[model samples]
Target: MAAAIMNLVRVSDPDTIVLGGGVAGSANFVERIRSYLNPKTMRFVSSARS
Candidate 1:
């Protein structure tokens, strides 16, 4: 999942990611995602938004 999101962010290079619907309900899940993204991805992957 991190890899997939990385690929998208690398390809698209967006400032923010907006997650809608049921995917927005999990705050911990989003934090987990940010954790996987920020440091691991060369400190470029921004956190997602609901």
Candidate 2:
């Protein structure tokens, strides 16, 4: 799932990736997604919140 999101990020190259839905709102799930995505794709993420 993380990989898939990362792929989207790479292809799209958006300013930010907004994670909606209940699953994305979870702390652990967000962390898990970040784990695979950190230091490679998303260099700097401002925050999950606005």
Candidate 3:
């Protein structure tokens, strides 16, 4: 699942990618993305507010 998402990001090059499924709202998942993605490209919505 994570690999698929990374592929999508690499191919799409979207300005922002919102992970809106079940795992999207997890703090650990969010942190993983933050740690893995380039700060200039990826922005994560706060699960606390969502």
Q: Whose lDDT is greatest here?
A: 2
Superposed by TM-score, candidate 2 places the C-alpha of residue 27 at a distance from the truth, in angstroms, of 0.2
Off by over 4 Å in 2: 44-50
Each candidate: what lDDT?
0.68, 0.74, 0.60
Q: Estimate the Cα RMSD of every predicted model relative to the unseen true structure.
A: 2.6, 2.5, 5.1
Q: What digit string (tens of lDDT, one per residue) describes model 1 on residues 2-34? A: 677788878998787666567656887777766
Q: How would you encode candidate 3's per-residue C-alpha lDDT over 1-50 as one tens digit per residue? A: 55566678678765655678778879887777657655544344222233
Where does candidate 1 stray beyond 4 Å?
Answer: 38-42, 45-50
lDDT of 1: 0.68
Worst 10 residues of 3 by lDDT: 41-50
**lDDT per residue (tens digit) for residues 1-50 in model 2:** 78887788778877877888998879998888777876745665555542
What clash count does candidate 2 reach? 0
Candidate 1 lands at a TM-score of: 0.60
Candidate 2, poorest ten consecutive residues by summed lDDT: 41-50
TM-scores across all candidates?
0.60, 0.69, 0.46
